[model samples]
Target: MSTKKISIGSKPTAKPVQPSADEWVEHRGNGNGPEPMKRLTIDIPESLHRTIKAQCAMRGTKIADEVRELLLQKYVKS
Candidate 1:
């Protein structure tokens, strides 16, 4: 067996690709910018969940947006 020494050299690293502000917001929910959002998970009956989903789809709205509007109307006093 022949003994050989391997040369160790530093390898160049490519910079990570970062999403622009709009792209970030489009993909990930805005969590770091102004008006940051927090996630809320809940359990609901399958039928009710389906109904809400269908209604939101028919109305061209998002379930989260609907829930947020309902919650704001219920709790936030004008």
Candidate 2:
């Protein structure tokens, strides 16, 4: 009688290569795609910061999203 043997365990495969910066921009720059986000830094009173944090926690939303909504409402007119 003859028997065949098969390999049981094998090494993991390598991860796929990441895209280059230029490729990333080209892939994401389509007109219908979302606009790239920009970072903003500001200094505010500690109390105001605390209030904003608390409000966001109570509303279950991020401070950044809340601020963006407020800014759009205040400055963007239809």
Candidate 3:
């Protein structure tokens, strides 16, 4: 579902060359001021998510933002 180029028999096959940033934005939202970040609805087991939600609430942030922050800090900080 994501872009990763591949070579095919002495030729490169790129996935419909990416549009420029502004063009991508315009195309995605159909000229309606760009769409918000795509939201995903997942079904995680409550047992695991309960602790996750509690920590997010304690830190006063959305679960997505909190998770992103924690992951970036933990994984990308090295």
Strongest candidate by TM-score: 2
Put down candidate 3 lDDT per residue, 28-78, tens digits, no spaces. Answer: 766568546656577989988998989878988899987667767988956
Candidate 1 to native Cα RMSD, angstroms: 8.5
* Candidate 1 deviant stretches above 4 angstroms: 1-33
Stretches of candidate 2 exceeding 4 Å from the true structure: 1-28
Worst 10 residues of 2 by lDDT: 25-34
- TM for candidate 1 is 0.56
The global C-alpha lDDT for each of the candidates, from Candidate 1 onward, is: 0.90, 0.91, 0.79
For 1-78, candidate 1 gives per-residue lDDT tens digits of: 999999888887988988799888686754576765689999999999999999999999999999999999999999
Order of the predicted models by TM-score, top scorer first = 2, 1, 3
Question: Model 2: number of clashes?
Answer: 0
Q: lDDT at 28 for candidate 3?
A: 76
TM-score of each: 0.56, 0.60, 0.40
Q: List the residue pairs that clash in candidate 2.
A: none
